[model samples]
Target: MSRLRRAAGRIWRVASIPLLAIILAFIVAAVVIVVSSVFTSTGLDVFLPLGAYGSLLAGAFGSGTGISNTLVAAAPLILGGLAVGLGFKAGLFNIGVAGQFLVGAFAAAVVGARLAGAPGVIAAPVALIAGALGGAAFGFIPGFLKARTGAHEVVTTIMLNNAAVLLLTWAVNDLVRAPGFSFPRTGDLGHSALPILLGRNVHLGIPIAVLAVFSVRWLLDRTTNGFEIRTVGQNPNAARYAGMRPIFITTLTMTLSGLLAGVAGAIQMLGVIGFYAPGITASVGFDSIAVALLGRSDPIGILFAAILFGAFRAGAPLMQIETSVPVEIIDIIQALVILFLAADLIVRRVFRVRAAKPVISELATVTRTWAGGAPPGGGA
Candidate 1:
């Protein structure tokens, strides 16, 4: 009976996270809509039909186009979320994903535009590789500095973001600008870019995003290297004592994290923008950090969280159109989700009262008996 109780407790704890996250998100969304209505003199009447959620569903899944747009938006988020999630598993804060993403977009744009005669099959792969390389290189710098000179990654990454913005702006404005136009953006990537997937502007990057989520799941859960990374993250000193090199692990993890972030940029450039622009990749990388946090850093959780965020992003415009709600309401709700997720101890306290001490002691006895061991006091 005690053994069964413990098993049930474990299951409940595992199930509570997603349930709480969804509930909190809805509650926050409702509050935002109500506030918006009150301020706009509608007093909840304008937020009708679907109540506060009408715009959300309409923008995300009301039509085939909406659903496709959501998926398209989810692509870069998956990549960026994976980058942050992987960094968390290695105990590294990869706040430089924004910079890495910009570097990737620039690199892919330069490579793809130059390869004029190459087929999509060839050009796409080369551009992605270039983006990945650029992102990896950017990530490696902070890792190197952290390992060798004790420079914190957060500061270095944030500084690098400003530098990346300037550098990309210059590159697009001067080097990669289209001949007939004076726009501060790169030349358009032609047919060698991403293929249209749904006969709409949505591209094949959606499938690639799904595959990346599965790949990241497998890598973290099934691979030996992943085990080492987790160990290092949990306790660097213990990992070092167990004959693992912390420095090497840190460097490798950051590199891979950056590579994934870069892929997001490449997909955005090739599939969405078809060109590299200074502000095109704005805030997506930072938003991915929130996605990773809301998902609890689990790969599958991150995928769902990415979709949720994508839905908000896709639906924001509709929310503004149909109701007086500001598009910034979605941002507020996302921020609230991250805040609540980070404060999970409060949720657990409210919803999961601890089992009494006597109950816990009784459960321990049963567990020991099942394990073929005597109870703590020696009597069976």
Candidate 2:
């Protein structure tokens, strides 16, 4: 009985902040909606005055198509969130997910285009692997710099992001442009290279994303490497004292994080876009940071957080079309969610919720360890 009660309490504390933040964001969004309605002279009242929220619901999950779209949108986000979340777990900030994602997509496009005649079993996995490798390769740059020179991953990753955009532009224009096409894009992926899943828009990526959630959970909770990662993240000094190499751990964590981000790009390409094109990614990598933060770097929490963001992305169009409310409202609401989470004290105070004591030993250790300065145990 005591164990059961404690378990429930743990669950509540884990879930309460995000849940309350979301609710508060929505309440504020409703107010924004009302204000926007008042400003618009020519509006349908959405055909019902109280129908803005209803429209959002209908657009996101009112039908099978909506649900599928939401899932599809969520797939890449889940992967990206996992990438960032994994980095957070290791006391590292992998800000290069955007670059990793783009490079991965570019690699997948090249590989998928080349494998136009292969079987799905052969082509799909290879394309995805190519993307992961590309991301890992790019990820290595920052990780190596950090481990060897003590340079900040944040600065390196951000610079790499800008470099990647130029690189992607060059790759598309000079190398992969489809014959006789004016626009910058690779050729269509072979039919077999296309996603095999529920329908045209939806793909196997959803299942893959779902699988990733469990795989990551198991890795973090039940594996030797996971223990090492946690140990290094919690106390690099202790890890060094215990004979663990911080350089290797940091490099590997960034590599794996990039791999996940790369997989996200590949999934989005093969599963949704069916080809590589410039601007295909609409800041999915940046959004993943928010997802990771909202999810608190937990795998399960990331999955749900990704889904919520996906719903917003998937439904924004319909919500705008029906209610005449600008789609930017969704962005506002998302920003509010992040703001509330960042100001947790405000949320707790508003709700009169008691703060939970820290239970995890390694929590927030990442905030201080990135500069590669001496570890807590007095090691370099």
Candidate 3:
């Protein structure tokens, strides 16, 4: 039917943007890798026939352990990407996911380590909830400042990140250090701290990540609250005229975004570290921003993007072991992906593609024709 065809076309068009971005990113990364290898080795032949690319692929996906490690690395990325992507949908910039992540990890560590004699089921949920709440509280500060004082979130969030690093250092060094040790970390969590899945460290966090992706997609696409958030992001004044509260929406979205990021922190602790340390989270929060951008702010795209990042993280060890290449190559590839995705205009211009407006207009005409002159907003 014409209606079906129109719907299919719309889906394809919507899907194409991120697809193009990803393809371009990979191509650019490949070019960079090859060129760099050639320059360092004095010939492309040294790098090309060594099976480096094949080994990289195999190290990431050729065995169960490789796949498990990839999924494990990707777990935090999924939640962090959703956090950044959700904030973008609401037209807010959240650069403090790193701080929020730390707070969440600290909260979970404190709770999981101290809660005595509780069953794993109860203790794990309690710790995770505490972690999420802690992250949400930290996230709420920037949102509140932005809503109340016209403060730029970028500045506040970035400042908060520095403060969080110092505070976490203090906590880990002075208060949470193991009873008899000088190490700047809390005591190891008990069995109850882990989220068991398939007898591996994969943990319950993977399912949580999947659920978070689905929940974010639903919140953005199918809910009234989502509509209000999008409306405000697209046009705040128009949203106000339509009775949507931009400030409330902004605060709520940031809070939820923080909550998700916090969940990432908690899961990282529960699934990987088994305790909190000041440096454990590193820059995953910042990396999430790149992941979200590469995903084009779509949840499904984010899932795949996170996996791609995870694959790089997962394969770094093998890449180092087999090829004597520094693990930093993965970082270089990731950086290139982010750079290309951020400069989307360059890709569009280079491709000489028609602008999005004309494509959208053509789709609209097809949809209108398929509806046989029905009311514009009405479903067929």
Q: Name the lDDT value of residue 96 in candidate 3.
A: 87
lDDT tens digits, residue span 145-212, model 1: 76666566778888988999998888777777867666676666775488887858678778887888
Residue by residue across 115-152, what tens digits does model 2's lDDT show? 87888889888998999899889888887777777777
Assess every candidate by TM-score.
0.87, 0.92, 0.87
Clashing pairs in 1: none
Give each model's clash number. Answer: 0, 0, 0
The CA lDDT of each predicted structure is 0.76, 0.81, 0.75
Candidate 2, poorest ten consecutive residues by summed lDDT: 371-380
- The candidate scoring highest on TM-score is 2
lDDT value, residue 198 of candidate 2: 68
Ordered from best to worst TM-score, the candidate numbers read 2, 3, 1
Model 2 CA deviation exceeding 4 Å by range: 42-50, 354-363, 369-380
In model 2, the Cα lDDT at residue 36 comes to: 62
